[model samples]
Target: MTSHRNPAHSLNWHPDWSSGGDLTLLSSDEIAFSVPSRPILAVSPALRPGAGGLLPLPLSLRLVLYFLDLALYGQLDFLGPSDNYLTDVLSLAGWLDSLGATSLINLLLVSGRAQRWPLAVEFLLGARLRRTDLCREALNRFNDDGRWRDTVWQPPGTVSDFATLCPRALPLDLWSSVDRRFMWAWVVADVPDTPPSFGLGDKFLEIYQTP
Candidate 1:
């Protein structure tokens, strides 16, 4: 949150989405925006309005507006004010599962909006959302690029290069998920169980036995 500003004259409201709305959503930064609740309520049963006061969300005004704008209007280009901002939008959508906005983001990504964006953006969003379906969508794109076999699987680069695939910092849990599922798929397809033995394997086994 930045410095608190006057709610009435805050610079944080959405310029296009703040009018003709039925709900007053206040963000943690004390910025308020008027957004329609009908579309959201139709899709999400988790965001019911409270008795009579404005709804408060524990997100920045930018994020809240982005979520509402995307969810209600199916707008994909209104990314908020920051570098690599889609990551933040995906994070907020993933956290608010009850909002039912994740599907909209997923749809936009798979429906060609993500082609202009980094392919890794979809992959990282999948990990953030904990959706294997989304993860597979990203994986299929990578596979289509011929990177799965040539670069990701049998690489001069290592499996850790998958981390490099992400333009932003990778969280430990998401990385673990990617390793377990994403890399495991490649390993299963690429690794052979045969008589061929490698010195590095022997060395690793020896180190494990010594410990």
Candidate 2:
């Protein structure tokens, strides 16, 4: 059950974790038992494991991307309200949802995978995303209530703040919110809590600002 961290991609791995505890549905609710039904299944070349028919994962890394693959194949029932197979992963004793934003995006923002499962929002977020349009797609996927909805097991957030994105969405756009604090999960994942005017949007902006 040991894990290693790769902060650049914000991913952690347990190279030899091949045990039976891998429930059909993870507690994180990132993947599910049905994904073949979606018509616009999102795919990415970046996620491919390369020519060997296996992800040429980093040396000594035996990461089990089982949940990720399930989403790729479209087994995403956790996103829908109809699905009730989820098991709570978060253990906050006295925490409340006043902080807003329970999007799975927050979990990915911090844990690389939705390991802890944030539940402030009513729906799951991130499940069928194209790496290229992460932000707008997220914005477009927002329900009429202005909250992001989940319908699949897409990665919660960009692999890194520096991950490529559209020039116009601008990283700064993610802030300016009283709720949606999950988005902040990315800004503070590596560190702790948002720093004073840390202006993470600027870091995001810088990524796009450069050639």
Candidate 3:
């Protein structure tokens, strides 16, 4: 169905999506986005239109349209290093159950692109996403990159406390798994066979302490 954009409705129409849109979606805030059916349907099979080729979803217009744009272009670099942006991307992907978007985000998180982010961000995102590999990668970075640890110790006072990074404390089981990985890394290191009491002990206690 063809949809017309009305500027008076405060409708922010995206140039690319507005051009080839067949499916019309209504956001919770009453914004209308005319997006192509092909790109969204290709990734989200469960997404369907109602009468008049319209679908109402409980999401902000930007949330819905941004996701569709990502699906349209299959771009991963759209993500920012901030936790909120990453969380929003993952939340939208999961809500839509779009495997393509989910995989794209996962790949982005695990790639060199994420390496520039604070290892704490990587670790927390990994834990939040329940991807063990990412947690391990962050821990591995901590072991390899002394600079990361130094930052954790002397956080420029601008960064958020590691303990306050994520909204919720990691589940006890996940914390235990990460703790085990840290212990394993220490075991395999060439240093004297002692615990992480050197410097990492305080960092771990400060950050990963389970509630």
Candidate 4:
């Protein structure tokens, strides 16, 4: 919890599924969120070379800590302001730290839409650039989602260096999911649009015709 804003605005909301919990989702203006799980880690800014962080906690050893009993006992109010300025940067950074640079670039674009630039830039610069089957799988699923429509595909200004990030490009496995949730970020950044000299355009065709 960032603990900087109103304590209630942070990850302080209790999920409404426990005892005395009403599983009613509020309109976007309300704060009752049904957010999915994100990764967990803590680190510093990337611009300052002296700032410190470590290799991410591997995905194989994933651990989720949700205290259902605690939420049930407290029954905390789920309502709060709709503004994302109340978003906890520290919490967002922790989640971003768990993903590689390739994925972080996409997430940063999403955060940029919410105006969480502090966390977005932090994740973008610090993220590791690696392409794995897992990343490909996740991207494939995103391509299938309604959110991937071109109208909403706005990535931030931070993804311009994708060519330098991964030079030896690999082809996408059309049969597999290929997690390209943030592919639009690269497009908006102009790195993958022209098929960079870096040799990694295998995913360009299918992702371009995502419909």
- Candidate 1, residues 1-211, lDDT tens digits: the string is 3332222321223323334544434433332334554222111112334421223443333343334334222232211232222233333343444433375465444433344443444554455445556666766676566543222223233445444443244444444334323342221222232211223222212211221
User: Would you list the C-alpha lDDT of every candidate in the order shown?
Assistant: 0.36, 0.28, 0.36, 0.29
What's the CA error at residue 72 for candidate 1, in Å?
25
The C-alpha local distance difference test score for the whole of candidate 1 amounts to 0.36
- Position 79, candidate 4: lDDT: 31
Write down the lDDT that model 3 would get. Answer: 0.36
Give the Å shift of residue 119 in candidate 3.
Answer: 3.8
Record all residue pairs in model 3 with backbone atoms less than 3 Å apart, i.e. clashing.
none
lDDT per residue as tens, model 3, 50-96 = 32112343333334433433322222221111212222333333333
Model 2: how far is 128 from its true place, Å? 17
User: What lDDT, from 0 to 1, does candidate 2 have?
Assistant: 0.28
Candidate 2's TM-score reads 0.25
Which residue pairs come into collision in candidate 1?
Answer: none
The candidate with the higher lDDT, 1 or 2, is 1
lDDT of 2 at 99: 25
